[model samples]
Target chain A: MSEGKGGGETVELLLPATPERLALARTTGAAIASRWRFTYDEIADLRLAIDELCLTLIRPAQQEGEPRRLTLAYTLDGSSMVVRGQVDKPNPAAVNGDGQAPQPTSVSDLSERILDALVDEHGSERTDSQLSAWLRKGRSVAAP
Target chain B: MEEVFEIAEYSDDSTPVLSVRGEIDVSTAPELRDRLLGVAQDGYSTVVVDLSEVTFLDSTALGVLVSGLKRFRSAGGDLRLVVTGRNVTKVLEITGLVEVFPIFDSVSEAVST
Candidate 1:
């Protein structure tokens, strides 16, 4: 249908759960956000926020042994814009792309806490009858 | 879609408070490192990192804090952890970082000592 744009056009970008893909994610996300003419701050937020999306999906989804697919979909229009993220996992995802859920490494105390917190914040949870956890993790931005 | 990153409010005073929120990562770590260092460098003897609002953190980010803690302590300042939830504590305990930094129940307690 009509999403404020002229015709039927949707943008989709995919990135792996690796640090190497972070730059790409930010670049692509910002580009999409810019299409709607978002402000610099808005675009920056989208960049960092989308980075979290990858961390959430990658670490929690445990794609290390294999490869987890982080898919982002954004629809832009003259009036509004939308971004969506998706991943496959059960309870809080995994850590560092490893399907094996590892406790924090024995290093720094704050580091450990940070690792666990990242998991809960990024992991996908199945709702009553729908897969809505991933999308919920994404933050929206509006151009001005 | 809404953004997913968390931003912590950091304060550097006689008693520094690193108010953290959301998740911390390599991408957004400089902000945190600067805050932590700023307090420690300002000669604050007590640095309290409030993780009550911090829902998530990572190794690289944690390393940033660890180094900050060491630097703060080296400068005669002490870095204290304000535990917020079991999830974060679990990581600390599992990682055995609990032995390194002083852990407090709250920011008030962290600053008190």
Candidate 2:
């Protein structure tokens, strides 16, 4: 765990990039969100956001038959939480022989709309050797 | 570790009801898809998915439900939902699925309508 600038806590998790493990990610997010005093609805949104981010990174790895791992960092400050995740680089052998970089995995339209509505900010970045996604949600003042 | 996800099939009078419990994510969505496909293939025109016991749902599960809805509608039937959980309702609302699927508060209401 790391300390945020606001003296908040940040938890890091590394797990196998498999669908079965998605629940663990969601559970961890929910637990932290609850501790931060997020509302029930806010916690639910965080859970779904974390699940969607992890699954987006895991799909390409599964299709490639590579046993990749996913790393997630959940950072909670005074009024908001940010969750970020990255998948391990794929096998060099799996790279296209034409020296072209693989396209970043695309989220479905439904996933896009859900993420847009749930998080205050979210996006993904892809480099030749790395792919990552992140989302930030703020606690509503009405939350207890 | 895999989460506990269950789907039970029973009849609400003459209509088929799939009662699902637990979290539905990427891993468990295939099971849901297969069961829904099974219902569609069995020649059932209308089916009700009881999600009152469901705790969570992600886009993968939503995609499966949308596909199931399409399959049922294409067969000249319909797929309805019985939703109770806040999380599930929020998801459906987020995706504009509340307008697509006939939603009810109870299984009996879903079957009766």
Q: Cα lDDT for residue B110, model 2?
A: 92
lDDT of 1 by residue, A1-144 (tens): 234234524577766656556567656877876766766655554555455455555554443455566666665533434445665443543432433333344322333333333322333334432122232122244334
Candidate 2 per-residue lDDT, tens place, A1-144, comes to: 889667879999999988888889889999988988888878888889888878667877777887888999899866889888888786554444553224333236777788899999988766577667888999996435
* Residue runs of model 1 more than 4 Å from their true location after superposition: A1-13, A16-144, B1-13
lDDT of 1 by residue, B42-111 (tens): 6776678888776545455667778877887787767788886755665566556788889889877777
Q: Give the interface RMSD values of the models in order.
A: 7.5, 2.4
Provide TM-scores for the models. Answer: 0.47, 0.89
DockQ of each candidate relative to the true complex = 0.10, 0.59
Cα miss at A134, model 2 (Å)? 0.5
Worst 10 residues of 2 chain A by lDDT: A98-107
Q: List model 2 lDDT by residue over B1-113, tens digit each.
A: 44578999999899999999998888888999999989878889899999999988988888888888888998888999999988899998988988999999999999988
Q: Give the lDDT of residue B112 in candidate 2.
A: 88
Worst 10 residues of 2 chain B by lDDT: B1-10
